[model samples]
Target: MRCGTRWARSNHFRSLPQRPDSMSIVLTPQELRSHLERFPRVSLGYYPTPLDHWTQLEKHLNRKGRFYAKREDLSGLAFGGNKVRQLEFLLGDALAVGADVIVHGAAVQSNYCRTLAAASRKLGLDCHLVLSRAYDQPEDQGNFLLDRIAGVSIELIDEPLGAEQEARKRRATERLAAAGRRPYLITYPQSEILGTASFVGAAVEIFDQFQGLPSVPRYVATAAVGATQAGLLLGLRLLGWKGHVLGFSPLNGGEYAIQEAIWSGIRAVAQLLDIEPSLEPNDVHNLADYAGDGYAKVSTAAVDAIKLLAQTEGVFLDPVYTGKAMAGLLDYFQKQKIPPEEDVIFVHTGGNTALFAYHREVLSLL
Candidate 1:
């Protein structure tokens, strides 16, 4: 729940982790792209997902500033999400290490594990999930159903995201090793940098996409905890972007805990890039105000957001992730934390399937 403890040294890096160079060098978007591309990766999702204008949302909300959605939901993988970008680098390392299977542990309906399963199947690799049966998704729906369809092995556990769930993943890894299968446990912090590092590349994508917009966004808001937020922070900082990243969390970790994980992730990604971590942990706008009830639980605002976005923009936001984040963005607009006249971008990390899993909750509001 608290995003696992701070990242210990990750052992799965594509290259040896190095300290950030003491020198500060401002890298252009093009230069940063070069630096990021040096790492090993396998293409999975469609890159540079469209930064489409929320053409109708402005008038729908009667807002002054323009709004846009960075369409990560269209990331063209198994029901796209922000995780697909991370997995390209993650699975790349998995294959490089001669691994035949990926062992991942997460919430029962995690978008990360679901996308990972689909990516593994696409690559002809096996995937074994150690899912925490902590949430109330009793029926096989949303990500769980998709995982079932993918035909990956599942070891369901009664525990939440504490030690036992993680231990199950370790035990599964041992079993696989004994069975002569090369396994890559994604929970292992070692190779996580590979995934987060790819996000720096995402920042570059954002920078390039903004060129056609009215102005660079004042805030880039999304549902993120650790690696995704870290990548955006590091990559944006590296590109000398001035905008803030509003990381709206759906999980109920104290703000400090989530912020610390994000900070640790930022440092790790910077080390991998061999660049100075110029940003501080406090630099992250890790807001929990919009995290409804907690991870996977429904919230009134999120449902309203889902309904509003679907009706106004013909887009759907999942209960677990994007919906809550959309709520946060709207709240910011309402509270004037983000001036209504200032342009903003919402990164839609997809999981609309989760809507079906919350039929009772969503339909009650609808």
Candidate 2:
């Protein structure tokens, strides 16, 4: 039942020949699921999300590289997004531990909070959301609307970071505990490990889809938020995928801190799976330049990128995360950072619901 030992017994391990390269460990989707079965996971999002070729997008870009999109957007929960995957393990842990209330903190229009609110309702658990403000906007829209619709108790805080926000979330947890309610706090350094583990399963799905391609992808790109990027990179490493996994920052955090967070998640996942950590510090690649005007603020390039994808590929990307990441991917191609013939897979982490909050900004692109 150990990590490496269990992997060795899987059909994928027995069937596929080991590569000559250093990445010899590989796990198929089925094997990966089997390994993950040991963990507590409540079924949340739809699995094995669409992996389709973005031929129109490639044609529009007039680039030599073939482009594919792994549609995590269609993950199928509370309008669907990357958070659904993370919530699977997170809420599962809550229910497993007899938690009656779920507490988490995020931005005013956080897709994470929206998804968590819906998930808490579905699991029949009381949901409490601590919304931290980064701007002076007083309007409640987009994911915030959905959060309210889900009947989650909301606490708005002026502090978005540092000790103040942490103190607020801690006090909320204490209040719930005082009422004899078991509360599960989903915050960094606590829920991130389980949250990241969900995307390890996602990587397995990506690998399986690549098998249909004439050639394997050269790169996989996604917006980095520690958990998403970290889990994906770790899963790809475990699967022995040779492609580069690039994380484009959607927040203001510098590359070093982002990499550290990702690396921490990777180590946590490795420990959770009882496997030897194969990822190194260098493997945590992040592009910080695409963050634009900081967290949740859409830049001109991101707005244009959002428009282009919608016009050409009929795929909607949110102004916050995916649009910024798409802008990074476009910049990479324009700068010729990736070779001409190589294929790239972009992970659409999903935030179309948040587009409502930035309707004016996105419409201005036209």
Candidate 3:
């Protein structure tokens, strides 16, 4: 399906005011909140996560601009991360559909898997995890260790592709059904749309938090797997915000493929909200140059970025996702891609707990 075509013909969507030439379309938080309330969402994390100013880090970099962090790290889930926001909607949908068990697939140390396992326990539901050895890490460390401690059923696969992992989850769900259990699969491909809508709510929060600032942010940066970036982009679009959203990829997909995935999510969100897709193809920006070796691998730049943030701002970033995204943000600043005069916001989509798994690599950086 085309990215913006799905909801383009809707008369209700067409009646909405066009974005002004100055790009200063004002949308109140309450309006967005009203639309979001139409869907069922369970509280999974602390709301209105702090928007912290990183003055020391900005000073260290000698940036003549403001640097702010949206602390989704302090989200207060199992270990707290962006996944908590997604899980709120995902698990709520599961319960709404009368599901008795939850199924998800990711790397062995996936924060997503860990958080989902914890959420299932809290809700008194069973969780089944399909873990892949895609990162070539130890069997028991970081989120994997937490998974074991949570006592969820787990199935291990050796570096399965996307389709392979889905098939495994499908089989597991079938078995659960046969055993007289209702299963809810939280896999990325199927559930991203619902999970993504959470961040649209997040975007409204960010915009409202910055209302009294001296100047609004010129850009918002986040680690991109499509869901987070696409949701935030759609939120900004629906809110009529003028700032750009930059996504830094942690994996090897080139810019085009990443943009395509993000656009697919935008299309989904537009359909979900029954609104016109307000973004163009060029509006989705994904920087893949900073991925370094690959996903879940340590890199000098990411290590340095992690250390710098911790040392200067007392903030911790995971090597896999946020660290690399921060590296890109710093690089953009140094290269003048982001002009020094413009303020920027980095969404700290938390993964500090994963640091223990890469202790050796992280220690060597010191």
Which candidate leads the pack in lDDT? Answer: 3
Write candidate 2's Cα lDDT for 47-120 as tens digits: 88999899998888887778999999999998898989989987876776678898888778888889999999
Candidate 2 overall Cα lDDT vs. reference?
0.80
Candidate 1 TM-score, true structure as reference: 0.93
Residue pairs clashing, model 1: 10-190, 11-190, 12-190, 12-191
TM value for model 3: 0.91
lDDT of each: 0.81, 0.80, 0.81
Residue 153 in candidate 1, Cα distance off native in Å: 0.6
Q: Per-residue lDDT of 1-366 in model 3, one digit per residue for the tens? A: 101112212322345443343232345678777766655678878988889999999899897889999998988989888889888877776776678898878889888889999989988999989999876877768989999999999999996547788788878888888898888766554366766788888898898888868888979999987788988988887787877999999887742377887888778766655567467889999888888988888888999999999899888999889999999999999899999989999999998877998888888886
By TM-score, the best candidate is 1
lDDT of model 1 at residue 270? 73
Q: How many backbone clashes does candidate 2 have?
A: 0
